[model samples]
Target: MIVTSFFSLFISQTVFAKNMYRWIDDKGRIHYSETVLPKDINYRRESLNKAASVKEVVEEAKTKEEQEMEKRLVRLRRDQEKIITRQKVYDNALLNTYHSKADLMMAIKSKMDAFETQNQVVEGNLIRLKQELEAQQKNAAEMDRNAQKVPKKLLDGIKSTQKQIQELHIAINEQKEKQSQIKREDEADIARFLFLTQSLTEKRKGTSIPSIKEANELGLFYCENDRQCNKAWEIARTFVEYYSTTPPDVYNDKLIMNRPPATDTDISLSLSKIPLTDDESQLFLDVHCRESSLGKDLCVSQKVKDIRATFIPYVNDALSRTAQ
Candidate 1:
């Protein structure tokens, strides 16, 4: 009977060895493992431990491959968020930097100038490649067509022409790929430059006068009279920014008052009134002519005369509006 009990105990231990390990972590969470829990752990053993319940914990004990995959997934999500945020910042910079049409126009012009210069070099390479390819193709076609009529003495010449044709196609393809690569690089550079420029422009807007009304309160009139003139100055500033300099006289001339040519001393008669020069008026008109009668050609004599006649009435009318 003692021998029989010994055999039964041995069988029970063998069956228990096939089951999983179970334990609770420091955080009060249960865990399971195929291996026994270490004695160094502080957790109290549970009386309710069952092999079936601990099976789930053992299943969750991730392999190295699974752990690495999970880490990669987490990193991918984080990287995607960073990419989205970066794109948003780039877009916002473009929007906030270009406060005026003139500033945007200048930026565009600068981009075009740089792009055009580089494109010329690319174009030259492309043209050369195309010409060589065409010449090779023509030679090949002529050789192939003549092969049937030609003697064996010229067979080597035909083979040489075929080889030249193959080489030409390879050269053409290489040049084309190079051109494409250059174009992509150029586009990326242009995009980066635009983003930087836009950010700078937006930052500049913060330091500038906020609005026409605020400018009028400060007595910084550039053309016209009172608040209208102040508003015109804001518009003019935008144009100057875009153009990268003062606009042409034609645009600026429109803002001048029709005064008979005054000598320097005549212009100094009124202490309170700062006389507006024709050039100054022209600058204002060029920068801010959204409603001028002569359109963009206002600097022409006939257009100027027409604009002056129409503008004087409008300015007088605008003065009354300002007081209200």
Candidate 2:
């Protein structure tokens, strides 16, 4: 019985020794053994065959912080993907909705006209209701002067008229809000349409140097290649941020811009990276002011002209420095 038990122990030892397990301990020391311990199971490990070649590798379990960071990265990527998808949908709708800027303007005008007509009707009704309310109030006051009890019907009419006035006021306010919202939406659509169509049209025109007047009007900076444009884009971004009175808004590879001007004097700046060819691009700077006469004047002022004039030189100097 003793001999048989010894033989069995030898066989088990030989079988276990056929493969080796290598792992790192908590102290980051490497260890190799014929068998892995339960305590070392969570550590990153490798299994080697009899030839001493790695047969399998197991990654270490992530810590709590590592796991949380991974989850956050995943969520960020998902949100970015959602934004991209939504933008594509909007672009498609904008392209399909109108053939040109004129069409878009016409559509906007029609909608505004309808709203204006509705508001006029509401105003007329409000005037009539107020006159009626005034007459009812006078009748009530006369009854009170005579020391007569005002009828319940008259009192109820006064209350009803007051309630109608309150409701009409709310409706008028809501209508005005709607008109403002419509204007904003239409403006956005127009801007996007102009960008999409203009970029395509300009790309077909090929790269060319514009005249001083054209450059000032368009705020254009030409680049001969992708490398130059990439460098120029960064410089253009700084220029936009520095000159724009409004806070930053949308930023992406193709466009960088600030929020629309809130006051007549405030200037909003934008840069569009338009592809001229497979290897060439142009950075276009645009200045915007509030949608008022004063704002229009501000956009054409010397201050704005100076801003546009510097765009090309600013980018050129930046590129020259980088080249050096």
Candidate 3:
């Protein structure tokens, strides 16, 4: 009887040899059998040898929703990669272009001075053209008073002077706009440079401060997750309202802003919430002044700098208190 039982066990093992299969059910239970049931055919399964080593694996079929989610994840990853690439390029340019913030400021001043000179020249021409137009008008009026018809040449001269004056006005406005654009671009560059250099310095020294001056200079606040970011957004909105001279213009989940500055003394503030990942976000604050010399000076003023510098700390303290 013992010999017969041993033979039967050996036969059973041989029969199950390469035909053994392992699979997981919908409830996540592991199952092993010599034959796969039709109901478990679509589930992920593995073929096993007599030694219980996996011989082959068959993947489970994905649902449409799962496939779509995978596609979205791929696209999101690609977009994130592109953003990282662009940021690297910007950082390299900032580091290579100027050695110091003062140097960058000087370059901006030089360019702005050139624009100012051009505008001055346009103003001079405009004044001369106005005088010429007045003279031509006087001649035409004198001719009319004497009951003489105004000469076609004189009329044409007045029209030409007026046109030149108009052109000069347009040119002056364009130059002012260009100067404003330059200031905005240059200030942004300076802020970026400060941030990069500060980071590099901290890395080299193997130390980090709780508050980064560069972050303050750039008017940026960072949050590690969505909950903190949402709370920070409200704080940023209040900060903008307290500082902005312009009235509110837009308010939304991703952006909060005030109208553009209407006067030289007016300051408009805007905040944008940028997502770095599902959990991480950045709040960026921007200050806008009028497109004039006074307005430009205001942007770089100590008062404005203080407002920016305090933003992150304000949010940090508020969030900490709430947690407590």
* TM-score of each candidate structure, all chains considered together: 0.26, 0.54, 0.53
Better of 1 and 2 by lDDT: 2
lDDT of 1 by residue, 71-158 (tens): 9999999999999999779767666776554676676667666656766665666566566656655665687788845446456655
Candidate 1 TM-score versus the reference: 0.26
Q: Report the candidate with higher TM-score, 1 versus 2.
A: 2
Worst 10 residues of 1 by lDDT: 264-273
Arrange candidates, best lDDT first.
2, 3, 1
Q: Which stretches of candidate 2 lie over 4 Å from their true place?
A: 1-26, 32-36, 45-57, 198-324
Q: What C-alpha lDDT values do all the predictions have?
A: 0.47, 0.86, 0.84
- Per-residue C-alpha lDDT of model 3 across residues 101-134, encoded as one tens digit per residue: 7888888889888988888888888888888899
How should the candidates be ordered by TM-score, best one leading? 2, 3, 1
Model 3 segments beyond 4 Å from truth? 1-16, 19-69, 209-324
What would the TM-score be for candidate 2 when compared with the true structure? Answer: 0.54
